[model samples]
Target: MLSEPEVAKHCAALLEHFADYCEQMDEATRGYVVRLAWELIGDQMDRPSVRRTRRGH
Candidate 1:
């Protein structure tokens, strides 16, 4: 299992890579991808660790 710091580091890297990928996509595709990403992220925010982190526990 990853610690919060490790997860944060990986998420940062992934966001940077995702941004680069979106830059190469057309507007419509980028919008779709961003929406999907947010949906997935919102879903993940329900996990225990994520909820704890969000609440600053």
Candidate 2:
């Protein structure tokens, strides 16, 4: 399992790449790119540790 900071860093990197792809992609291809990103992030977030937040006082 990744630590919180590592997960955040990876998410940022994924967003950066997604933004770059979105810029270069044509309108028709943009949806595919967005869907691909959504799937990737969704998969990561589905992990148990990442899905739950610590309880607050």
Judged by TM-score, which candidate is best? 1
Minimal lDDT window, size 10, model 2? 38-47
TM-scores of the models, in the given order? 0.44, 0.41
Please provide, for model 2 over 1-57, each residue's C-alpha lDDT reduced to its tens digit, 9 standing for 90 to 100. Answer: 234788868977977887977878898788676656666555543456755456989
Check candidate 1 and list the clashing pairs.
Answer: none
lDDT for model 2 comes to 0.68
Candidate 1 lDDT over 6-55, as tens digits, reads 87688667767889888789999887766656654554433566533225
The positional error of residue 47 in candidate 1, measured at the CA in angstroms, is 18
User: Each candidate's lDDT (Cα)?
Assistant: 0.66, 0.68
- Stretches off by above 4 angstroms in model 2 are 1-8, 43-57
